[model samples]
Target: MSQNLLIVGAGEFADIAYEYFTVDSPYTVVGFAVEKDYLTEDEKFGLPVVALEDSVTRFDPAKTEAHVAITSTQLNRVRERLIKKTQDCGYTLANFISPRAMVWRTAKLGVNVFIFENNVVQHGVQIGDGCVLWSGNHVGHQSVIGDYCFLSSHVVISGYCKIGARCFLGVNSTLADSVTIGADIFVGMAAVINKSFEDAGLILNGHPAEASRVSAYRYFKLKAPT
Candidate 1:
């Protein structure tokens, strides 16, 4: 059963999401929806581009599904905001779990999730809404990834770990068992986390992954998540 789907952007990530939904999932991509300000083109990949606010009118929300096709810009706040926007606009959100990825039947995932190839989401994992698990990542058992988090390729999240909202785990980063990360934190590339970080907005980097002097919001030049 291929459901009609509307990807919520027309950028690079949107193109990737469209291809994945069209080829792998049971989704027939019907169109794209983005803000009018960023809607540069009238069409993308041969689909019509509608304003995000107007998507529900163009495509009946009950009949169509939407997935936010945004990346880790502004520490994933962009994706986070867009997900909320779509939900508020009365559209049913969609999830794209790759056929190639081995997602455990017991693992629970939220709406608009994009799980790429070669990822292992182990038993009892709870991945929140709008998260992106990029290719080749390993999520160990009972881990909790919060809403709008982005885990880059090959990152390793060990057993029983908890990650907070709008966080970005860089490529090849490693988290030890039972570790907890707070909201809006950025784990730099290849960093290793062995302990829990309770504080929010920290920029973590290095082998043992110490927090840098600069705040994550400041480093990203973002005011904060509104």
Candidate 2:
């Protein structure tokens, strides 16, 4: 029997999550939910769209699970906030691990993870809650990815590396072995990280990635909603 799932958000990521979970996982997506103010449609993907505040009552948290399908927008703060909100509503979060992902049996993953196709999570890897590993990424042995991190396509996390909470590793970025990345760091596309960075809230870029003067909020254009 498939478990019922209520996917939060009605954006592109939510649609992608719906497709992945429907085709690859054991969860059956029964509905979509978003903040009432953000809702513009009554239905999506043929599922009834409900306000997230009322989703618990409509979906029955005891029988249904939820997956927050928001992207790493706003330095991942938006996704993190919704994740916490859903958890507080008594819905256990669901993980969507693709059947095509080569996750070693020794790897540990927390709830609400979305690991896409061809992700190679090697032995002894620890992926924390609400992390999203896009397709074709490589997580090397014994690496630790902290909570709510977003690893984009083709990112390579070398062995024994520690990526801190709420970090965003862009496509094709490479982390050297044994490096420790501080919390809320943004590693830009194709950046090669060869050393440990302890400072948080940095926007790192370039071939050998260096901290940019721009904040993530400014670089990513993440302004508070008006």
Candidate 3:
């Protein structure tokens, strides 16, 4: 019997995965699953919607594997939540590494990973499970990317860096060698991290504007006659 595949979340990413599954993959996509609150459509990508809570019954894991297609736009919270949910329901998360992706033989990859096209995972690097490495990114040698991390496109992670779990590295971001990014941190797009980021919060790119608050307000047309 052919392997059954169920994709969680029904959005743009799901659409991409569905296309890949239909054309490139050998497994059949049985349905889409989502949380009760976010389950909007009766069907997605032309496949029936199966609630994440009842997915195991609707799609048997023994015959089917599931994948979480939630975009990592907001870090790992969305993907992580669905991963735990599907796993707890006795379903295994499937990893989809596009055949077009260039991954070295020595590179280590964990389960449920989504690696898109034109991405390069160099030798000796370790990517943990539940991670989403978007298209066009370069992960350098010996880098340790923790579980549940999300890396957007065109990002460059230099050699030997440690990226913590649940971290969100935005598009075009670059992390220099040996830098340690703490868990739950949000690195904005185009940010260059030359040093370690130990704090876990929003770290926007570029330095703060030098102009004083009042001066900046007036310059931006925010100040009005009182």
What are the per-residue Cα lDDT tens digits for candidate 1 across 1-226?
7799989988899999989998898899999999978877888877899988777789888899889999999889889889999999988889999999999999999998999999999999999999999999999999999999999999999999999998899889999999998998998888999988864546456778888788887888888646
Best by TM-score: 1
Candidate 3 residue pairs in clash (backbone atoms < 3 Å): none
Give the per-residue lDDT digits (tens) of candidate 3, residues 1-226. 4578898888898888888776666768989998988888888766799778877777888888988888764456678778888898888778888888999999998878989889999999999989988899999999999988988889999999998887788788888889887776677788888878663546666442011223312333332224
Model 3 spans with C-alpha error above 4 angstroms? 207-226
Question: What's the candidate order when arranged by decreasing TM-score?
Answer: 1, 2, 3
Instruction: Predict model 2's lDDT versus the native.
Output: 0.90
lDDT by residue for model 2 over 98-125, one digit each (tens)?
9999999999999999999999999999
Per-candidate TM equals: 0.96, 0.94, 0.86
Clashes of 3: 0
Q: Local distance difference test, per candidate?
A: 0.90, 0.90, 0.80
The worst-scoring run of ten residues by lDDT in candidate 1 lies at: 198-207
